[model samples]
Target chain A: MNRLACLVVVIGMALPAFAQDARKSGFDYMGPDTQAMQKDDLANPGMLSVLEGETLWNTPTGKAQKSCAACHGDATQSMKGVAARYPAMDDKTQSAIDLAGRIIQCRVERQEAPAPQREGRELLSLSAFVGRQSRDMPISPPQDAKLAATRAQGAALYSARMGQLNFSCAQCHDDNAGGHLGAAPIPQAHPNGYPLYRLEWQSLGSLQRRFRNCMSGMRAEPFAAGSTEAIALEAFLMERAAGMKLETPAVRP
Target chain B: MWRLLGLLAVLVSFDASAQTLVPYRIENGAITQSLTGVKGDAAKGRAIVVERQKGLCLLCHSGPFPEERFQGDLAPSLAGTGSRMSEGEIRLRMVDSTKVNEKTIMPPYYRSEGLERVAANYKAKTLLNAQEIEDVIAFLVSLKDDTQK
Candidate 1:
């Protein structure tokens, strides 16, 4: 009788520990590294957008008669680590610039072309291709004094409350890290896989699109595409994912 | 006896309502049908690729047989995946891609629940039904050129 009682106590203690491990190992965030290795129907389809992006990368436009190739030749070599270093602070602008903003800057300042619309397919695809070149590299945004202030601004945006839902990014991604919003568990909004091909979006999309979605979820007015606030937030997210490998054009739930 | 009959009638009505639900046709399927109808015809699944729509299987995967314009360079092709997976396994993935990977961005065609926050009109319906999923499975199975097993 005493042995049976002792065994029951041991089983009870072991059960909770096992559950904790299971929770830790199970699919909660579905990080990019894991997604890249996992087999799925969407994986191949995501490449179609990449091919489109390649075409856009080389096609010239505007008065400069310059394409992306004009400035950055053979993307595979030139763009190798570019994606992993953005939402970087510009020494000239003294503000944060994400991959999209950088592309627009190139067009406006170098090529002298009109900026593409926020959700344009050409922009999304080009960004997707550039991001893909940096796949598997660790995120490494510059951290000098000029960027420190921007990083601080980004941190504030991450935790600040906005909209009718009154929920900040931290509420779903951090404070309630392992909690479920419904059937889907919330992931720690890592930017390692920007310019991802989300099944929900049914096409390639940028981190900025996801950010806008979160703001809309909060019922707050989303920041415009190239806004300083959005760029700062991107910088902050990239910093958070500093050590993680980049998996651009990744598939997401 | 009367109370028992009334409860039976209510249950029947609820079941009937469940069958007639219509959600978004992100893929090809009879939206008014149950989740069972969302399964694609494996034979016809290949023909459904419309660039932006359902036939996008090649976007991330490369099939064994290569079509020049539609093939993607980033993902592994799906030419002989039927040889790798069982019919039941393919069915489950086609019906709901999430069962395989929670972080997958793939839509759950067989999803019948957990959509409370979606637009109200789509609340009752599933993304796709079982029939469509099965059809897609059939098409995938046919892709196995070498039936080694």
Candidate 2:
């Protein structure tokens, strides 16, 4: 498993060979400095939020007077590999819900508490905490035997050209993955990292934040944070990243 | 009769300058030069080509830009395009390169036909306007090979 194979053939007219089965995460493409940062949990800036999330996880403030651990027990044991199976089909909603969406849902329905903020500070803390539970685990987002119609819709949305640029995700990420987008290497976008720290962002953030940034980069009006379109795209990304190791709280350049 | 003629004159002027949706014809992976009726501004074209917000050409295509620190290494360079391709071929490519290579990653900057999975908001518009297309063409046409530059 030579990861250097991914770096071959980038200079000439020849495109890099696609190893679709490799399941490479975006973190694999980061600079050594970034890799070092993410590898060190103590040094990673994202860990700030993870620490906050740990405290939040232990504190019981919901109307039902229960913490995430009350029913689930210690997250280290109970939440292990949980993030790997997200954007899952919510039995009640009957639609896909990512890790963040599922957590918000739990707050409302299970805990009988007020709806948590969408990508708010608290939510990000909790998401990063929960996501960190599955670090190094292989991603395997709900592989229901039945193909989801919503997944098909998600495929359409992924390929759709939006914004003033008339560019689709397929135009760049799919067709030209591993290609350079102005000195910036465009890695095959696997949503394995979330609550990841980005140099441009200068902080740890959720996948939804990155999605919004990309949408605006195309000069297109972005979908709302928790809208069906955003969720669908999330599901599609999670599916695309299946089998890749989760790098939650990963660092990026 | 004088007033009627004057009103008609105003209406005709408005229609002539209006930016209507234009149609393009593709034949054998090329669009012949017969259909285009546009004048280009190379200076403006230079700006458009480098603009990440709109043209976004730099996202994939590397070109001669000493001032800009970053240039892509994805698609072929646009530096010596004039020496390599005819204006007509360049025009066709810019409008819709997929006509020549269906699987090409380059977006059709000036066409809206036969595209599947386009966002609803941008359904009615082409990526670049006719004048912008002409400007880009003029800029490319002015690119005289590296020896000449």
Candidate 3:
């Protein structure tokens, strides 16, 4: 009898891992009209930023006056699958850095140009352009020992309660997803379609901006832009969204 | 005299904005004493629960509200709560659910302190005032129909 009980416990522990296979991206929860809009680049408004980024890629600026094409020589070939593997380790910082962060670093260090303001049109456009290269590819977070601590911190932050509402991200996205929160359906909170446009904003925005919006909605203080906590959360989200297809420059409502 | 009157008006306005809440006592996981000392109106309580910008109760709880098309499923259904629990028990849960379950997702409708990272505009403000808490309790205790579950 005890052996049977032990076997049941072991199987119960394994159930959630198997359940994760059925995980759905926020895309699945979107209305059909929005999905159709994402499928057609012509109809999607986010493509404008991607086109701007493409122009910026070939144009030279700063003291070096060297375009990204001069070093990388065409984003289509050199940048494929690159966005899928971020927030990767930055050698200088010895911490996780997101795709946007990496772009700012390159502009400052390699191009000898000043870093663009966070969430600025320049940054958003560049990120959207680069991320567009990895569309439809699976998210592939790195499996390095160095990134483990940051990933763990991110996971903790996802579950930690904050704000006057005392809501943790997991409580809504994990525990009660598919339910309605006053007319709006609570999605699973995947980070797959970042650098994507939100209908609510009527413009393109980053994942960090979304985080701040949610934190404020919960009546809590928002994490600073580019803070370690925000990066850590991004790292964890990418890992959680591992195997999900990228939807860069995607449209959402 | 004008200066003195202006000073008094400023103090009064400041006091109103500060929102000094009523006092109450807790006993055995329940606030046996009422915060406002006056009985609450059940009709107004029902309206508050359903309103999106007020109690926000429908955001995380389903109840016997047929008109509400988008009730949540995060917490227990509010139906038949009066049949299962006493008035004081419900009042305590409204005041602060963390006292019962440390990790409850249900926001404390009446608590105003010890919260972390609260937004600047919302600091030191409870989700519901003391009288609002009583009104909600009055509405909840009236729901004695277990069949609604």
What TM-score would each prediction reach against the true structure?
A: 0.55, 0.81, 0.87
Question: What is the fnat of model 1 with respect to the true interface contacts?
Answer: 0.00
Model 3 agreement with the true structure over B1-149: per-residue lDDT tens digits: 42343334321112345557665555665676777888988998999999978888988888999988888776788999899898988987998888667778889887767777888888888899888988999999999998985
lDDT of 2 by residue, B1-149 (tens): 42443334321111223335455554434444533475788999999999987788887877788777677877888888888877877877898776557666777787655555345666656788878988988998888675532
The residue pairs in collision within model 2 are none
lDDT for predicted candidate 2 compared with the true structure: 0.77
Task: Sort all candidates by TM-score, best to worst.
Answer: 3, 2, 1
Q: Taking the tens digit of each residue's C-alpha lDDT, what string does model 1 give over A67-181?
A: 9998899999999999999877666776677788888888888888998776688788888889879987988887666778777888998887554333568756775566544
Compared with the true structure, all predictions reach lDDT values of: 0.65, 0.77, 0.87
User: Which digits, one per residue and each the tens of the lDDT, describe model 3 over residues A1-253?
Assistant: 6999999999999999987786787888889999999889998899999999999999998788988888998899899999999999998979889999999998999999989888999999999999999999999999888999999999999998888888889988998888877677888888888898999999999999999989988989999888899999999999999999999988888
Candidate 1 lDDT, B28-110, residue by residue in tens:
21122333445456556566532324445544344554333445433335667677766655654655554455444344555
Q: Pick the candidate with the highest DockQ.
A: 3
> Docking quality tier of candidate 3?
medium
Report the number of clashing residue pairs per model.
Answer: 48, 0, 0
The parts of candidate 1 lying over 4 Å away from their true place are A1-42, B1-149
Instruction: Candidate 1: give the TM-score of chain A.
Output: 0.83
Per-candidate interface DockQ score? 0.02, 0.29, 0.51
